[model samples]
Target: MISKDKPAALILIDIQKGFDNIEYWGGERNNPNAEENASAILKLWRENEFPIFHIQHCSSNPNSLLNENNEGNEFKEEVKPLAGEIVIKKNVNSAFIGTDLKQQLDAAKIETLVILGLTTDHCVSTTTRMAGNYGYETFLVSDATATFNKKGVDGQDFSAQLIHETALASLNGEFATVITTDFLKQNLL
Candidate 1:
């Protein structure tokens, strides 16, 4: 059960269409069900009338898939931001950087955060770390976030699932409680 003592906010980070360009994003991404899972959680949050923030990555790289001018910059159809919901635009990994996210969350008196998004090793991880350091009790939905594969310095190839799992492992306990989408929906709904 959620505590009424402290408010909670749902942050859907950078789940943009640009990420669909698999080859452009290092290819073979993990967690194919991330968007659907996120949408389920989003529905639950909306039904509960909890605070929700949709983070859009406005990439500075003009050629990037998520560049402001590109269609990929748009949020996915499944989890699009509804009217009156908070939408924060960020160009960097951390949503709090150069954005009024912290101020908005503070103004809403939010003390607990439920974060889920694309690219688990990057923006999602960075934002979760900051949220924890900022003293927010954060829960990261493991099945609702994912990442693409990366080539090592020695030219070794790593799978996206490996990266996703490692990223979650690093954040769990230290920064946020890493749980599945089912776990979150079961508890919250």
Candidate 2:
């Protein structure tokens, strides 16, 4: 449980339409209710007037679904940033790599970060790892992130659920504390 006395920020990473393209991201995904969970957290953060940072991934690859010119580059309605909220755009997996996200968090005096978003094994994991390395207390909402199937180096196929679980497990104790959205709401509120 997080203490309400500490300042925290919600960092939503790459919750965009591009992730809806299952063909591009591989086959089926895990956590069908991920967007709903993200929405719930976003709503709670907004209602409490907590800082929220929306990370947008703009792929530099022209063939990528997340290309800046593509409609898929747009944010999903569920987690779109409202006016006055911060929106950081990046072409890399880690939001802090080429963006001012860290500086902004520092300036805002954010002691803790609640992170959730698309593709549990990708941007979400990368950002969480970086956040932990940068010395911020990070919480990853398990149900609020999803990932699609992937092919291993030996051509073995991996299920989306397996990938998601593995990613979360890798980050659980090292990068962030893995918690459910329900748990977060119950503890924070």
Candidate 3:
């Protein structure tokens, strides 16, 4: 549950259409309901008038699907930002790096961050680490974030489910509280 004493922000990181290109990211993606679950959370944040931020990745790699010029860089329909909501553009994995995310959060006096978006092991994980290090109470929604299968260092193929779980396991204690969408629905409502 979120603390009522401090202001919290819901950050949607790279929920861009580009991520739908499963094979490009790795292979099969886990958590097919990620976008739907994230959309539900976003609706809650909006109805309550809580602070919200949308992070967009303008990949530095021109060939990348998320490149600025690519339509794939556009936010997905389900959780697309409404007019006047804050949208931060980033060229890297971490939303806090080379962006005014920290500054915006600081300005808004935000103390807690609820992050859910894109591949759990990449951008989501990186931003969660920074959020925790920067002293923000961060919560990462397990079912609202997902990843694709990845090639192991030893040349083995890893399942998307395995990669997703491992990423959450690694970040659970040190970076953020790994939770499910059900947790939010039960407490926030």
Candidate 4:
């Protein structure tokens, strides 16, 4: 359980619309379900008045799926940021890289971060590890992040469910404290 007195921030990573389109990941991206989880987290955070931050991925090349004006590059409707919420754009996996996230955290006196979003293995995991390196106590909501599996060297394609489970095991309490939405809600409130 986390102490409510400690300053905490909700870090939302790459919950962009691009994942919704099957063509982007060759039908491997877990879309609709991932967005739903993100929405729940966002709603809870907003209701509790916790600090919330959003990260947007921007690709330098216009040909990239995350390029500016691409439909997939925008935040999904289910968990769009409200007025006055901080939204930071980055080209890298970690939200803090080349963004005002660090400064915002510093200004808000945030000591801990609770992260949830799309693509668990890539953006979520990388950002969680970097959050630890940045000296912030990090908690990863395991059920809220998803990653699609890829073709293996053994000629087997992995399932997104398997990837998500593996990431939960790998990230629990090392880079971040792994918790579920129910557990977090019980502890937070």
Q: How far is candidate 1 from the true structure (C-alpha RMSD, Å)?
A: 1.1
lDDT of 3 by residue, 40-89 (tens): 99998888788999999999898989999999999999999999999999
Candidate 3 at residue 178, lDDT? 89
Candidate 2 deviant stretches above 4 angstroms: 1-4
The positional error of residue 89 in candidate 3, measured at the CA in angstroms, is: 0.4
Quantify all predictions' global Cα lDDT against the true fold.
Answer: 0.93, 0.92, 0.92, 0.81
- lDDT value, residue 21 of candidate 3: 91
TM-score of each: 0.97, 0.97, 0.96, 0.91
Per-residue CA lDDT of model 2 for 17-84, tens digit only, reads: 98998878887899999999999999988887888999999999998889999999999998888999
Q: How do the candidates rank by TM-score, highest first?
A: 2, 1, 3, 4
Candidate 4: where is the Cα deviation over 4 Å? 1-4, 29-32
Summing lDDT over every window of 10 consecutive residues in candidate 1, give the lowest-scoring window: 1-10
RMSD to native for every prediction? 1.1, 1.0, 1.2, 1.9
Model 3 scores what on Cα lDDT? 0.92
Q: Which stretches of candidate 3 lie over 4 Å from their true place?
A: 1-5
Residue 153 in model 1: lDDT? 98
Candidate 2: count the clashes. Answer: 0
